[model samples]
Target: MNIIACIKQVPDTNEVRIDQKTGTLIREGVPSIINPDDKNALEEALRLKDKYEDAKVTVLTMGPPQAEVALKEALAMGADEAILLSDRAFAGADTWATSTTLAGAIKRLGNFDIIFCGRQAIDGDTAQVGPQIAERLDLPQITYVEDLEIDGNTAIAHRAVEDGHYIVKTEMPVVLTAIGELNEPRYPSIKGIYEAFREKEIKVWSLDDIIVDTSQIGLKGSPTQVKRSFTPATKSAGEMLEGSTQDKVRDLIVRLKERQII
Candidate 1:
């Protein structure tokens, strides 16, 4: 089984900051980490590899050179291979263009039985890339997958919905977006980390390396445009009630009624 796990290097939420001038994230100085949800997806892939002796997990990412860090982390966690899709032409791509680029790269990589990705990237929070990639590849996709098992060429997935989760069975060559409930991610072991750095030389692919239409990638290809961006105003502090327990209860109810919160 050939499994591909798509991952991203995102700004650490706690240290994230926006550039007031560019209306974009200030990534140069801030710390970066693997998207939290992508870790869960990688964990699921590792579990599948463990179950199937022939399964090979390959991690892929598209970003600046620093994104190599993320691929290395995946390798250290048990991925058999890592690929980096990097190029100036891929800059400023929206979800549509991004997925298109990824789909092209996957085609060049050869046959794949399963593709895994996070439900959404923390930075974008759009949750569109995974489904869009499936669309581009003409493959069925299962989103918000909490659990998954493969038998023969079929995949049984538990998909999360508003009410509850429901099981869905799909054929091989499918895309799956994993949720946090799937499984706990494993840390890099001493041996794994050593092998990741010593034995692996992550393959980097540029725009020319993959089959892509120059008119269908990067900022020029993106239909969505940002007119302006700014942080929301800080919320006002809440009022504090003071008195005996009974008095405080009465005051709370009065405030709630006054604010129409009840």
Candidate 2:
């Protein structure tokens, strides 16, 4: 089985600045890390690889040149190979554009038995890319997966539901978007680190090499654009109550009513 884990390096800090003029994320000098949820997905892939010794685990990511750091991290965690899709034309891409680019990369990489993704990215919590890629690839997808079991040519997983969960099964080549609650991620050992450092990965790809249409990439092809983003101003502190419990409740209710919060 060939398992491909789609990973991303996102800004570690939440203090993202929005460029008001362009309505885009200001990524300059933002320290990035591997998406936390993707780590869980990678762990699941590694576990499957361990269980089935013949299985091959590969890590794939799309970002600027710096994103190779995330792929190396995945390598250190036991991925067999790594691919980085980086291109100037892919800049300012929204989820749709991203899914398109990733699908292209996957197609270029040939066949795969399974694909894994994080439940959501901290930077862009739209949670649409995984399902979108599945649609592009014409495969069944289980999102928000908290548990997965692989058996031969099929797989079963517990997908998150509104109030509970749904246990679903699909044939091989299914896409699974894993949540952090699925399993505990492992750290890279000395051997892993050494191997990763020595492994020469496939270099980044641009639109030219990939033969992607410039119009269908980057901000131009992105259907959804951030109209506005800003941090809300802080509000005043709450009032202090000095009375019995009942009195405090009454006062709180009155204050809530006065403030039109109820």
Candidate 3:
């Protein structure tokens, strides 16, 4: 089985700050980490590889050169290979363009039986790329998958839904978006880390390496535009009412009425 796990290097939200004047993220000093959910996806892929003797897990990402760090981390977690899709033409791509680029890269990587991805990246939280990639590839996709198993060429996935979870079965050559509850990600071992940095060569691909239409990549291809972005105003502390129970209740009601929250 050839499994491809798509990952992303995202800003550590804990250290991210907004530029008040520019209404943009202050990324200059922020550290990047693998998208938390993507780690779960990678873990699932690694587990599948462990279970299937012939399985090969390849971790792929599209970002700046620094994203190589994310791919290396995957290798250290026991992925068989890593691929970096980097190019100036891929800059400022929205979900649509990003998925398009990824789909092209997957095509160039040859036949893949399964593609895994996180439900969403923490920074964007849009949860669109995985489904969009499936659309581009014209493959079946299962999102919010908390558990998955394979038999023969069929994939059985337990997908999370609002009410509960439901099982979905799809054939080979499918995309799955994993939720964090799927599995606990394994930490990199000493030997694995050493091999990642010293023995493995992460394959890098530029725009020219993959088949893509010039009009469907990067900022020029994105249809959605951010008109403005700003941090929400800090909320004020709530008032504390002091009185008899009945008196306090009455006062709260009056306040609610006054604020039109009744």
Choose the strongest candidate by TM-score.
1
Q: How many angstroms is residue 130 displaced in model 3 relative to the true structure, after the best TM-score fit?
A: 0.6
Off by over 4 Å in 3: 238-262
lDDT of 2 by residue, 75-134 (tens): 998999998888778988989899888888888876899999998899878899899989
| Runs off by more than 4 Å, candidate 1 | 239-244, 254-262
- In order, the Cα lDDT scores of the candidates are 0.93, 0.87, 0.94
**Which residue pairs in model 2 clash with each other?**
none
TM-score, candidate number 1: 0.95
Per-prediction TM-score to the true structure, in the order listed:
0.95, 0.89, 0.91
Best by lDDT: 3
Worst 10 residues of 3 by lDDT: 224-233
lDDT winner, 1 or 2 = 1
User: Looking at model 2, which ten-residue stretch has the lowest summed lDDT?
Assistant: 208-217
> How many Å off is the CA of 244 in candidate 3?
12
Cα misplacement distance, residue 38 of candidate 1 (Å): 1.1
Provide the lDDT at 63 for model 2.
91
